[model samples]
Target: MSKPIRNSTEMTDITRLEQANAMMRLVNQALARNDLAALAALGFCHPHIGELKQQGGFRSSSIAQNTRMITRLRKVGDTHAQ
Candidate 1:
């Protein structure tokens, strides 16, 4: 009953976290590849990156995380390089 409901809620949170991580990975890969089209499709652009860079707190954490992710992706080699 209540135990099962709690488990269900926890599972939902895990799923949401996984989804967010996947989205971040995709965004990082796109940036590494310099895939403007993919970035545009994901609603990311120079201004968005700039905003993230300028913000502090959670926003800053998010930006730092994303920047690291992109750097890692770039190091792995660009799959979409022109």
Candidate 2:
């Protein structure tokens, strides 16, 4: 069973995960449009750019997926804390 968050750091991690997902959405959008300028502005370096291009396309992580991940992580944390 999952437990309630015991500290602020856990909440911060969730927030960071959401933020990273949002950035990924932006990156995907830029890639879709072939917007090199936008990709560069978003800080995609040469290696990452080539890799993303090779991958062709990817689905951005959905909110439901993140929620499930958070739930799973909390359950693991609860187990470890016991």
User: Listing every candidate in turn, what is its Cα RMSD in Å to the true structure after a full C-alpha superposition?
Assistant: 14.3, 5.2
lDDT of each: 0.55, 0.73
| Candidate 2: residue pairs that collide | none
* Residue 41 lDDT (model 1): 89
Residue range with the least summed lDDT across 10 consecutive positions in model 2: 56-65
Worst 10 residues of 1 by lDDT: 1-10
For candidate 2, what's the RMSD? 5.2
Clashing pairs in model 1?
none
**1-82 in candidate 2: lDDT tens per residue?**
8555555666577777677677778888889899888888989887888888888644544645776677776666666567
Question: Residue 48 of candidate 1: its Cα lDDT?
Answer: 78
